[model samples]
Target: MPQSRHLATELPGPRSRALMARKTSAVAGGVGTTVPVFAARAGGGIVEDVDGNRFVDLGSGIAVTTVGASNPAVVAAVQEQVAAFTHTCFMVTPYEPYVAVAEKLNEVTPGDHAKKTALFNSGAEAVENAVKIARHATGRDAVVVFDHAYHGRTNLTMAMTAKAMPYKSGFGPFAGEVYRAPMSYPFRDPEGMTGEQAAARAIAVIEAQVGADQVACVVIEPVQGEGGFIEPAPGFLPALAAWCRQSGALFVADEVQTGVARTGDWFACDREGVVPDLVVVAKGVAGGMPLSAVTGRAELVDAVHTGGLGGTYGGNPVACAAALAALDSVERDGLLQRARAVEALVTGRLHALAARDSRVGDVRGRGAMLAVELVGADGLTPDPALAAAVAGAAKAQGVIVLTCGTHGNVLRFLPPLTISDELLHDAFDVLDAAFAATSTTTASAR
Candidate 1:
């Protein structure tokens, strides 16, 4: 089979089918999967299934492998760290790699305002900790989040998330004092509403309903990840940050999916020159290792008591070692520029597709994180069925694509930064074919 993408048999071939049977009995139903074929190995935008089929990976394991799933440097670092020591528990006995990773985060995150970092095991934990720090620092209780936001799965974060079906359904007794504000979704926003105007609208609600003085922090994703990869209108983020500053509310940037050179910048907020008081990072941070962090102003982070913020696996030495090496790969490999290049290729193709198909209502996003919102014949009604059909067609053709958005009518592309140009273009070709196939079927059904 070719290194790029080759199918020796149908998707979820014999070996994969056998594995699926085992997984069905062992794994819980709630833990879903996109592709049924179990991966034997993955690297450089290609996943090889146990059945010997190769697939082009457009979904970089949901953007967790920005530096590639098995980056050599990260692998070596993990190996060395495991050999030395896996986990002594940072709270029990601190290690050099943990402190070093925190230092690196402080230096790289936006602003030179004497930042500090607290590591966690996942984005949700980091977000929960950020809320804790904010409340402690401000002596306020209310925490503000945006509509179309996806924080995490923890109880508090599930409350922070906007969507209700899968993430919030059946879960109850959520954290209180969490206020939801309207996001600056340009495509859905009223026509001619500038970013500043949108910010003012959300701020008005915050002031009126939540009371700015009662709010400790206003947490938002500069480019919302699960909310259809929605990039806020220009000037929107800066305006919100300014309001947070004036109103004495901490501004938190949930960059879990947008950080680590994923959005063509160190952080998406950097594009707008918006320096958030607190930034949550995960997913691509450690080259697929389970690690997350909250990096923020010194005073706010230090406001917590000496033993206030920590977990047993927070800043695990192995994960920290992987992060250090992954950071080096990002800088040395110039993945930031590469992410921009990917945006150009993907957006160009998606925009052309929209021109040819009315079902593609909007093509938007930045860097490697892009999405196309599917609509019905009238071009306004969301067509989630079409999105699902397109995604299924692509998957059958050995291209791994992921669907997201509040309505599940958006097809998001989050290819690894290290994906070769040839492979990326091939994946787009598969997508184009998928859209074409799905559109024809839809027209016939109508």
Candidate 2:
């Protein structure tokens, strides 16, 4: 088998089109999709569709499969655990695998200080729980988040999130006391502004609008994921963390998309030396299984009474077993180094592409998590249509890509670490062709 993408027919082939028709009738309209093909099976870096078309999986299911979709170790662990037992509800009957996963999270997450872990079912749930812990511990109410920050979709998380359409539209009357502040987006910020300066701007907003002393926690993604893969300027994180400490607000790092070696480090916060007091992690943790965790300082997390945080399937045995195996694979496979290599390779191609094309406004992100922001002729105005067109063209060529950003003008990549270099180069070749074609088509249409 060729290890890369191979298109057997046009995208959304006969089988996929029929499935789509069924989906339109059965699935809720609120739940949308990308690529428009039905995945039959996936492994390593290829997602094979029902029609037998294979796609170079650059999105990694929104950065959930860092250890690969069908990681052998994860599959084996899950199978063994499932054969033994599926779920007993840890809260009802404590389990060994659940405890083991907590121990692993406490040890691997940043901070040498004594820490504890609580498992959850999704990033949004974990984030909401993290806030509950912080507010309970500090005896405060306000939660601070940054502009372009994507925490999650639950009511509380939606309140923390910045975007309006799709995520927040028609979902009003959100949870209260969640405030937004400016982020140190290097690309969009004033060119001369340093990260320190940016942090000061945000701090001023918090102090004035929200009153820092009243805040319970300031949650942030070390590298903003859905909001365009924006990596904040170097000093920004450290400064915010410092302010949180000084103001008695727990600094929470939402590591859902950037954790578990996806960003060339165990967690992106480690790269900035910013040790968050409370860390919420999901996405890439269980190699494709659903699992999330809130691990942080022992004192803060323990402040809440026993049984304060839990869910029916927070840490199912099979999921925990998969997580343990996935964490092992990260260390054993040297995925951290692999992600860095991906960053170097992909960014090199993107930079060259940006140099040749004025619409390629910026190339940003860290490790395997990267993005290319599309723009108009002015090189500053967002060009979402162009981004959509490029992604569509790439999908037509059997390379699955994704787009994000507040304006939806950024093309993001999250290829599994196990993807071969050959596939990476080939995927870029398709992207280059897609960009050129889309730009020409857009120009001709105009």
Candidate 3:
């Protein structure tokens, strides 16, 4: 088996703390708190901190390195592209890498209909552009999104987003004509609403309140990412897609966190065979480079006049090259299928943990994009304090984990699909130990 973490000293040793201070001094004012350990380098499933502590990387840079950090093919392709030439700016002088990536996206994204793709620099830009295309195509003003959805952080996306604490708090006076609806949250929905019933209720609200005729698009994350990895019930997404088609509303699937094989399919929209008019992709697109895109129906994409969509570094050559190689690597290596295998590994461990601990309210997600939601003994109330403690304890044990959700009580795991089975299992073992230890501490405190 690969070597497990070797912790020679405490995390954030003297050297790491000094670096953190330098970062705080030099970096922007609003940058968030640095995590427990400062990474020196990462590969496969492990990140080495400056203090020589090896940590099992379960976060995968917030789901950006699905094909793995510094993948050989991605590194080689980027190096080759840099050696020849870097950016000519896709707007001024377009390059093949950008076109090639767009072509691949057109062919690979869920829709089989005639499709077009435009690249951008971040998930928020892709989402904003998707909305622009939808509004242009429908000539409508309103866009409807679900409660608990996380589109992005830009002003327009912030308006579309449903969570208010961090992504929307104090950041608003947001864009107008954005509406919110309920999600098919199986865990929390009313006593008897089936998945289909939940979807129907939401549609009713849209038709009666928002007026389908005035809505330009309906956007969703097939599996709610930041809202705690809540997978929509079986029939919800397809039914919504059908409703959008009948209402002349464009369906935009925000696959920024759930796309690129992280969820057992090239896109979650494909898993349900519910092709959206637009699909926003980023995070894992460039194998860690800053790149994003909107892929959708050709007519909808072309509806925007030429030069209406694009940015200065939308499809930078280096990132484009990395994306092409990453996509190829994902396909050739069967990372999509590998994602399911990783999911099984995670669920097997996490569900077992849930079985014993009442604090673990749920283990839910598809493929590698999984999370374990924490709750108090009542099994309904969110347990944010326990979740934070669990994450901090895991970090002390030389493992990286992330917490997210509307209530901030979900421990999300986004290990790279390229992580070895042994490494994944090792991380789970560490998690199991951490949970056991934390449970003991909780018992003692009580």
Give each model's clash number.
0, 0, 0
lDDT of each: 0.92, 0.93, 0.88
* TM-score leaderboard ranking: 2, 1, 3
Stretches off by above 4 angstroms in model 2 are 441-446
TM for every model, in the order presented, reads 0.98, 0.98, 0.96
Ranking by lDDT: 2, 1, 3
lDDT by residue (tens digit), candidate 1, 126-183? 9999999999999999999999999999999999999997899999989899999999
Off by over 4 Å in 1: 441-446
Superposition error at 296 for model 2 (Å)? 0.4
Better of 1 and 3 by TM-score: 1
lDDT of 1 at 280: 96
Question: How many backbone clashes can be found in candidate 2?
Answer: 0
- In the order shown, the candidates' Cα RMSDs to the true structure are 2.1, 2.2, 2.4
Q: What value does the lDDT take at residue 127 in candidate 1? A: 95
